[model samples]
Target: MRVDLFDFDLPADRIALRPASPRDSARMLVVRPDGLADRTMLDLADALRPGDCLVFNDTRVIPAQLEGRRGDAKIGATLHKREGPRDWRAFIRNAKRLRDGDSVDFGAGVSAIASDRGEDGSWRLSFDGDEPVELLLERAGRMPLPPYLAGKRPTDARDAEDYQTMFARKAGAVAAPTASLHFTPRLMERLAAAGIGHETLTLHVGAGTFLPVKADDTDDHRMHAEWGRIDAATAERLNAVKARGGRLIAAGTTSLRLLESAARADGTIAPFEGDTAIFITPGYRFRAIDGLVTNFHLPKSTLFMLVSALMGLETMQAVYAHAIAAQYRFYSYGDGSLLLPA
Candidate 1:
């Protein structure tokens, strides 16, 4: 199918510039077979049923944005995928101008020598560091802001909080599992009181989630691989929930993708730890999840396609139109939606 079928228009104003105060106060759009309803994150407890398994991605977003000059090229950098501790695939702002053997100097103690450039203008930039990637990135990197935030740069204030989910523990993602951002500790307690069960897995979301679907034919698009892991204990908990016949609801597309990737043919799950390039588009059969709690995504982006994959193309289009008309915030730090597969 043509990827253009998934495209929609979003006003610049609809892109959320800041997170909702108190986080959980953000608007919620619940989608059922009938239609969509506007609500708030406080309604989550009521929306979820008892024994429903809510899978969460606990991968924390890092301060991956780096500003440095490579020769005369003023390039903005985001460490997208890590090939090794020192080798990274970065998306440079002005990638067309740079070629191999060009040196991109990061701030003090950190400099990247460009080794090669890949298709789609991504560069294989090697860092000049002996320390681990986490340490190097933390020292010189800025918070990797979403593209929607114009003229806004990360500071020490927003740096600590802006791109993080409440339940983050593991670190690797360049993007936050944004749906988790709407949750607060109090809200989680309420969910527990309501008997809505939840579990977490780590899918260090790469920059790939933000990539637009350039493929006219959806099948032609090759997905970027990201690292993920599920331990034995989490697997046991998930299995127990499924054995009780509870509906599996994913917190975001990251958790949903990992769940689908870990699912066995017999409808069972196992401990999974590795990389996955699992790209879910429309018409794909889902094995593990029945519902999704997510945020509105950018038009023509992979996230929109993922949501459309869970629901239907027509349903997502209508739902998104409603969101746009209602002035619901979109993208990271945006309002959320709950969708069940149709």
Candidate 2:
């Protein structure tokens, strides 16, 4: 399908620079096959049945954004994936200034050597010294905010806490799973009290999520791989939910993609570990998840294409139109939508 088919006009002001004071206070637009309705994140329990399970990504965001210099040239890098104990694949800003085997000093005694530029133009960087790279990042890196928000305002201490979800534990992700940002302790209590079960998996969201689809057609667009994991116990439990006639609700596109990657043609989810570059587009049949709770996405983005595949192209267009006209927020720090196709 033409990528232009997913394009939509969004007013600049609709982008959310900050989250709602109380996380659950953020508005949620419920998109059903028949129509749309306005609601809040707090209403999630009411929107879902008692038997349903909400799947969340437990991957924590790391300080992957780094600024450095090589000689006189300034360089910026966003670490997307872990290649080894000290090696990472990073997308470089001002990449032309550096070359394979060139070392860039990131200040504070931290530096890395760039090597093996990939087909996508990202470079494989091996950090110097024996101290864990995580420690090096702590001293020098900043949270990798989505460009949509970063381009507007600088990342600050507030974003350190706001960009991460309550479920964050296993650290690796360069980007936050935005849909999970709306969750809070109070909301979790309410969900549990309402008998809505919840589970977690890990998908280290990469900076690739922020990349734009420059392709003219969906077929030409390539998705960058991200690491994810699903344990046997979790897979058994998720399968049980389906066996007992319960719906599996993915909390974000990250969770949905990982779940789909682990699911078989027969709809059974298996234990999985490793990278997934699953690119979901229209005409794709979903096997694992019954519904999705996700943030408003960018125009012509792969995320929008995923949602369009989940519901229908026309249905999502209308849903997005309603969201825009209703003044709902957009992007990573934005409002969310509960998409339940009939």
Candidate 3:
């Protein structure tokens, strides 16, 4: 398939610079076999059927964006993964200029020495401090907003809360699991009243999420690894939900990917902890995640391709065009959609 198959034109204004006023007040564009339907984020409870189970990625977004001056060069960096107490894997701007032995001085007096290049293009950084890197992140880091967001920078204040989900408490991810941001406490109450169930899982969003798909054909695209875990109790709950004839609805791509990665062909979910780099594409068999709630993704990106795999490619593009024509918000803090296989 041509990489362009997943591409679509998006207007500049559609990219959301900030989240909706009331987080769950964001719009929702429902794409079904019949056609595209417009709705609001709060309508999700009404849109989904009873006995459907929701699997949410509870991984919290860390304030991972930081500015550092290495030598005379001022560079922006995002912590991708933790390599150790003082060591980390990070993506830096102007990688060509940053060489080995360079040191980064993060604001609030924290500093790190570039140690080595990791598996991909990211670097290993060993910090020079007694304060845990998490503390430094709280003081020096900003939300690791996507590059596409324009107008104002991430420090605009509202992003600090808007970029996170209502259920966000655990701290690790560089970005919020966007879909989960749509559910309000009221929405959760509605789902519960209808007998819908939800379980939480963790998959810390990383720099891998920001990687542009470079493969000429998606089959050749290598997945970026992300650390995630499925606890025994949650696994048992998922199995019980399935046995009770509930449909599995993954709240975001991250959660869906984690579930698929840990699922057995027999539909059993087990306690799992470690790194996962499962890449979903067209023709891939989905062992888990029968339905998905997610936001519109960037054109020509792996996320767009993943949704294309879940729904047909043609339908995915068509739905996107409809969303654009209808003026729906896009990206991190944008509108959401619920999808079932074609």
Candidate 4:
């Protein structure tokens, strides 16, 4: 399909600069088969039946945004994927100024050598110290906020906590699974009381998630690979949820993509690990997840295409039109939508 089909005009003011205070207070646009309804994140537990499970991504956002200099040239890097313990693949802001085997100093004693440029224009950055790379980032890096938000304002101390979700544990993701940001301890307690169980998997969401679809057609777009994991125990439990007639709703596209990547043609999921470059578009059939809870996405973005697939193109188009008309926030720090297909 032409990428233009997904295009929609969004007002600049609709972008959310900060998350809603008391996270669960954020509004949620529920898109069911029957119609749309405006609700708060707190109403999530009551939105579904008791046996339904909301799958969450446990991957933590790393402080991967770095600004440094190589000689007299200024450079910026956003580490998107881990290649090794000390090596990461990063998108460079000043690509023309960098080359293979040149060390870039990122300040606070952190430095890396740039090498092996990828077709996508990202470079491999191997840290210079014997100390863990995570430590190096702690001294020199800032949270990798989505470009849409960062372009409007600078990242600050508040983002160190706000960009991370409560379920975050395994640290590697450059981007937070923002839909999960709306969840809070109080919300979890309510979900438990309502018998709406939740489970977790890890998908190290990369910066490519924010990349624009410059392609004229969906087939021309390339999705960047992101590491994810689903152990046998978790897979078994998720399968059991489906076997018992319980719905498995993904809390974010990260979770949903990982689930779809692990699902077999028979609709059962298997233990999975490593990278997934799954590009979900319209006409794709979903096998693992029954519903999705995700943030409002960018125009002509792969995420919007995925939602269009989950529901229908027309349905999601209507959904976004309604979301925009209702003044729901947009993008990573924005409000969320619950999509349940017929």
lDDT: the better of candidates 2 and 3: 2
TM-score of candidate 1 versus the correct structure, residues matched by position: 0.94
Ranking by lDDT: 2, 4, 1, 3
Tens digit of per-residue lDDT, candidate 1, span 28-83:
99999877778999899898789998899998888888888877778778888888
RMSD of 2: 0.7
For all predictions, the C-alpha RMSD in Å is: 1.9, 0.7, 1.6, 0.7
Give per-residue CA lDDT, model 2, range 107-194, as digits (tens): 8889999999999999999999999999999999999999989999999999999999999999999999999999999999999999
For all candidates in order, the CA lDDT equals 0.85, 0.95, 0.85, 0.95
Residue 194 of candidate 3: its Cα lDDT?
80
Q: What TM-score does model 4 achieve against the real structure?
A: 0.99
Whichever of 2 and 3 has more TM-score, that candidate is 2
Stretches of candidate 3 above 4 Å error?
150-154
Candidate 1 vs candidate 4: the lDDT winner is 4
Instruction: Output the lDDT of residue 62, model 4.
Output: 93
Candidate 3 lDDT tens digits, 73-177: 887788988767778799887777788898888878888888688667788888887988788888888888877873345466777777788778778898789
* lDDT comparing candidate 2 with the true structure: 0.95
